[model samples]
Each structure stands twice: as C-alpha cells, then as structure tokens.
Target chain A: MRLSELSKRSGVSTATIKYYLREGLLPPGERITATQADYDEEHLRRLRLVRALVQVGRVPVATAREVLAAVEDESSDQLSRLGTAVGALPHGPTTTGDDAATERAGRTAEEVQRRLGWRIVPGNPAHRMLISSLATLIRLGYPCEVDHLLPYGRAAAGIAEHELALIGEFEAPTTQLEAAVALTVLYEPVLLALRRLAQAEEAGRRFGANRGAGADPAADAEGEG
Target chain B: MRLSELSKRSGVSTATIKYYLREGLLPPGERITATQADYDEEHLRRLRLVRALVQVGRVPVATAREVLAAVEDESSDQLSRLGTAVGALPHGPTTTGDDAATERAGRTAEEVQRRLGWRIVPGNPAHRMLISSLATLIRLGYPCEVDHLLPYGRAAAGIAEHELALIGEFEAPTTQLEAAVALTVLYEPVLLALRRLAQAEEAGRRFGANRGAGADPAADAEGEG
Candidate 1:
C-alpha cells in the first residue's frame, strides 16, 4: 500500500505520517518509484505502536524514539535494560534542601519498602520525579513527606499489580508487540484518568472547608522547621 | 506580626507571599498604619494552605482561586457545588461523528464500572480527559479499548479510597491537612508508576506474538485493513 492508503487505513493523516517517517519513528517503506513508496502490515503495526507510546502513554517524542529503539534492538539485553529502566523509580520523596527533611524522606522510603515487603528498587526514575515534586512542595513549605504518602503508594502498587494479573484474560494480541500496544494504549489512559479523579477528590477534600478543622500547628511546625 | 514575620513563620518567601496576596490566594493582613500591616496566625495558616494547594497539590493558580473561594464560602450549597465539581464522571463516548468507536468506548466504561461494583461516573472531567486521550489513540490507529482499561481504573479507585481511609488515623492537623496533601501529591504518581511496571511485566510474558492473529478481526480490519 502507498502512504495515502496507509494513512486511510490507520486514520492518521498523510502529513502526520510524513512527520513520523521523517522523524524515523516509522521504518522506511519500499521506494516503488521516484515519488512513491509502499508500506506494509509491519509498517502499520510500527505506526500503531508509536502512536500508543506518544499519544496514549504521554511519552515525549524523543523518549518514544528511545523506547522503540529499545524494543526493536534484538541485540539489546531486554531483561537487563528493562530492569534498569524500571529500577529508576521516580515517585519517592524528594530531598528538600533541609538535611533533616531529606533524612526523613530517606528513612520514610526505607520504612515504606519494609512495610510493604516490596523490593521497590531505589533510584527509579519515576521515584525521582515524584520525590523532586515533593521536594518542590517542601521548599514551598508544604508538609509533603514519604511517610505521609507511603501507604497510598503501597496500596496503589498492589492494586495495579493485581489488575495487571487479570490482563491475562485479554486473549487478544498474544504477541509481545500486541500486548505491548494493548497495555500501553488501554491501561495508560485508565491510570492517567484515575490519577486525575483521585486528584480531584483530594482537591475537593482539601479546598472544601466543610469536612475538617482549620489547620495543624504541630504538623505545620514539623513541616517547616 | 508584619508581613515579613508572617513570611518567616510560614517559611514562604516574601516575594511569594506578596504574589499570593496579589493573586488573592491570600487575604490582606490588618493594616496597622498606612505604611505598615500586621498578620496573624490565620495568615500563616492560610499561606500554608495556599502553598499546599500549589506545590503539593499541583492545582493551577486559577483553579486554586476557585477552590479557595469554594472553601471560604459558608453557604449550604457549597458542599453540593463541591460534589458537583468533583463528582463529574467522564463524558460517555460521543456518537455523532464517530458513533461506532464512541459506542464501543461507552460500553467499555460501563463494563469497567460494572466489574468494579462502583458507580464509575461517566462524563466526569477526568473520564472525559481519559476518553479523549483514548480517542486520540484510536484516531492514531491503535487497537486499544476502554474495557481493556476498566480493571485498572477500578483497582486504582479501590486503592485510593483505602488510602484515604488510612489518613484518619493520624492525629489532628496531620490528619486534616496531610491526608488531603498525600492524596493529591502521592496517589497519582504511585498509581501511574505501578501501572508502568505492570506493563513491563506483561511485556515480559512472551506468550508468543501470534495470539492476536484471529481475535478481534473487526478491530484489525478497521485498524489495518
């Protein structure tokens, strides 16, 4: 099939298809003539995968490129690379310039891991991202701590794992590629939406003054001091 | 004390405090004279809350303003308004232009809610956001569905509620503010990170790449026909 046909079949526009091709997000189709190229089912699959990563997974283009490269590289040590990638958790507590707060966060991470009985490999990128976000909160004088957040993390992780286990029932896309696309496209939005809902609920609880008292002095002092 | 004292007490910088005041995110302190103003503990508390909303909660400043207004409003309708604001389910999949795909999404959302045994609100802003995101993926030609995502959402909601319940265990201010803060700052990131890990594990289960060969021929035809 030609580029236009591929675009029609994929519901992607010709221009965007060109962009994907130019960015090397899609493999080069066979050059049938000076002005024409033919794409195949494999190209369609690759395009879908790329779309899944960028559109649904919310990954940056460059990062998506790297992920695709990792996926396609047969020579790459998949398990080791995946472990390293997964190991870089980014959701732990961030270090607020205060040594005490930083120490508290470190201790809290350890405590949470121990309590949950999950290895929770340290230095995960997601962990760092979350911690940095918390550090930003602490710097701004909010009482953001890992201990305050640990149970939620543990519970969420447990539920997420359980849900993933049930994905085995999704008999579609038995191949790793299909599974990858399905999981990435389907579950990513669900997770993102859940977070958004949870955030809204939290906001309602916080800014909605009817539910609780004014504030806590000791907690405030502990957070600030 | 004066604004500077309030700043010192709150650990929020003078510039930020001024900005907050200007943005009406914080209220004016008592004017001691034309050139001087005095702030009380209330100011400190409010400042902390503002900091929490912005930093830990990641609420945008404009949205924060609305939330603060809702918080301060003492009308009986305020609670209902809060519920309305937070209780919005995602919009059910639209059917006018893309009826088939949207209908499928609606079915998926319903199935997810049914399986979870919770009233998964449709058309909720978060749900809308997720659906739109999924639509974008479908537009980009990924064979992902809402039902594939239902379990994840259900599980996440369960975990979040469980975590929220645990917040009541803390004493006073910690319980009051920290619970809200923990929900906002921690829940989403933890859930998202865990979901990512689950995806990685699913990818690890090399169930063979041909499993998608005959399943969902309609999806394959629509997507790659």
Candidate 2:
C-alpha cells in the first residue's frame, strides 16, 4: 500500500498524513524510491488510530504522539495506557488563578469522593473539573448540594460500569486502552444528548399541555415525532 | 459603569469586551458621547450571560448570538426559549454522507427512544451522535446493543431531571434560557469527568487486584487511594 491507499483506508487526507509523518505522530513508511514510500497494514491501522486521536478525540498532535507511544509500549498495562490517553484529552476548565474557588472546589470534591467512597487522586483533571463546576454553581447562587451530586455520581457510576465492560472485551491491552479512550471521548455527545432528550420527555410527561405551569405547548409539539 | 468597570465586575478583559461588542455578541452600552458609554446593571447581567455562553459553555460566537437573540426575542416562552438555546449547542460526530452508518444508527436510536418512550426528533444531533458512536463501535468490532444504551439512558434521565429542576428556578424566560444553556454546556465536562472517575473507581472495585487475570498490581494500588 502506498500513502494514497493509506489515506483512502484511514479516511485521512494524504496531506494530513504527511503532516502527521512530519510531526512524528505517524511512523515513516518504508522508502520505496526517491519520491515514493510503501505503507503496510500496520501503517493503515496506525493512521486510523492517529486520525481518531487527533480528529475525533481532538487531542493535540504532541499529546497524540505521547498517547500513541504509551499505547505501543508493551511494557505498560491497560489501565496505565488508559491514563495516558485520558491525560492526552483536551481539558475543559481549571481553577488555575482563582485560589478561593480552587480551595472551595477542592474541598467539595474531596467530600463528594468521601461520601461516594470513590478513591480518585487529589489533583486528577476530573477532580478539578468537578470542583470548578461546583464552585461556579455556588458563585451563580445555585450552590449544588450533596443531594445534587449524589444522583450524578450514582448515575455516572452505573453508566461507567456498563461502558467499561463493553471495552473490556478487547484481548489486547493496547486495543482495549485505545477503545476505552475512543469510546469515552466520542460517545460523550451521545450520553449528554440522550440525557437532555430524556429531560425533555420527562418534562413533557410532568408539565406538557398545561399539566404544569412552566410547560409550553410549543415544547410539547416539538418534542413529538 | 463604564466598559472598564464592566470588565472588573465580569472578570472579562476590556479588550475581550470590546471584541464582543464589535462582534455583536454583546449589546453596546448606552451611548453617552462619541467616545464614552454608560453601562447599567442590565448590561452587567447580559455581559455575565455572554461570558457564560462563550467562556464556560464553549458555544461559538455566532451560535451564542443566535441563542441570545432568541433570549431577547420576547415572543417565545421559557420552555420554547430553552429549546432554542439547546438547539444551538455544538454538535458531536454526525453522519453526513455515511448513509449506511446513519441508517444503522438511526434504527438503534429509534429503538432506544421507543424503548424509553423518548420524544426527541429523529435528526436531532444527539440522535446522530448516538448513531455515529454505535456505528463506530460496530466498525471497531465492539458492537453495542440496546442493553448498553438502556442503562445509560436511564441514568442520564435521572441526572437530567435534577439538573432541569435546578435551572427551572429562574422565573424570567431569558434568564431561564441563559441558565439552561450555561448549565448544559459548562457542566458537560463535570458530568464526563465524574463518569470517567466513577468508571476508574468501579474498575478498581471489580477488577483491580484479584478478580481478573489481567489485573495489574499498580492499578490496585492506584485504586486504593
């Protein structure tokens, strides 16, 4: 296979493939001549993975290279590899400059973990994200309480168990790690959309058609098939 | 208050505020002279909303403008305004030109909705996202089934109901729309982080130390906090 075939198979453009080659996100294909190179099936597979990481997962090229390196390093296990890939994910928000907010969020996150018996580390990005959200909620006067956080934790745990089990099938540690990262990042929209859709349905059931004061007829109409 | 005061109050820089004003993402303060303007509390509130939309929610400038336009439209009710804001959210992976995957995913999303009795439109971005994710799962040789989606839907619904109830506190339509949009966009990271963290915890409990052959000792140590 040539670079063109690799592009076709991976659904990545040849120019992007060359860019990846230059960035070292993809390995150099075997040089067939001065202007041509031969890509193997492994190259195709690697290109596909790189595309998923950079395009679909929105990982930085540098982070993608690090993650791929972790993936290919047979010395690391599945869980560590997942950590590498997750670390490579683009972060949302953090409490970098706001010390008060950071401290407040940190305390709340710690309490949430204590209550749920979840043993995540102190400075994990997820921990920071959860903290920052809570701090923002409080600042906005919403002040999310234990009652609010608990349901999300329980619900998230249930969904997580199911998703993890699905990816647990890949026998290869690298494949399992890659699938876990890909599925987690890519399917977020699915999870959130379903949740929002469910909320609309539940709202309709509870409030549509004058069933409640806040219900709008237009919402009901739009919600229908 | 002037733009400088608004910047101080909102924690957004003056340059960014000027940019937003130039971009029409923010309404101009009342004109007092050729070079000066007077801002009020209303301006402050609107600026906060815009900041939440752009900085926290990651909504594109154009989409944020439309959502704000909907907010200020005055004709739509709160629930309808919520619909507008939600509709403007950035989408996930879509099935453009991939008819086979779209068809396959459409069937699965329909089944998921029908089973759950959801009232979402067929071409909703979330529906497409669900389809795209499922198609990717199938392509990766780790096919997902109704069994997986059902649990996620159930859990997501539970979280959504609570979240909607929180946003439901705002009595004004525009404020309600803004809060709804803000919560939906900003807290996604919160939700996903919590989910991934929960997954890591659950994985530890189920497979970290001794229950499976692939269990890594370091994973066990990491799991134990």
Candidate 1 lDDT, B98-216, residue by residue in tens: 55555555565555544544344565666565556556545555445545565556556655565555544545532343334434443454445545543443334333235434554
lDDT per residue for candidate 1 within A134-161, as digits (tens), equals: 4444544544555555555654555445
Predicted model with the maximum lDDT: 2
Put down candidate 2 lDDT per residue, B1-225, tens digits, no spaces: 988998887777899989999999877889999999998876777777777777777778998898888777778565566666676677676654465655676778887877775775765666666777667655433446776789988898788788778767877756666676777766677788788788777666554555456754345334332
> Tens digit of lDDT per residue, candidate 2, span A1-225?
998888876667899999999999888999999999999976776776776677667888888888888777778665666766676676667664465656666777776776776775866677777887777665544446766687888888888888878877867766777667777766676787787777666656543556466645345334444
C-alpha lDDT of all candidate models, in order = 0.55, 0.72
Residue runs of model 2 more than 4 Å from their true location after superposition: A1-47, A136-142, A211-225, B1-9, B13-43, B93-95, B132-142, B210-225
Question: What value does the lDDT take at residue A128 in candidate 1?
Answer: 50
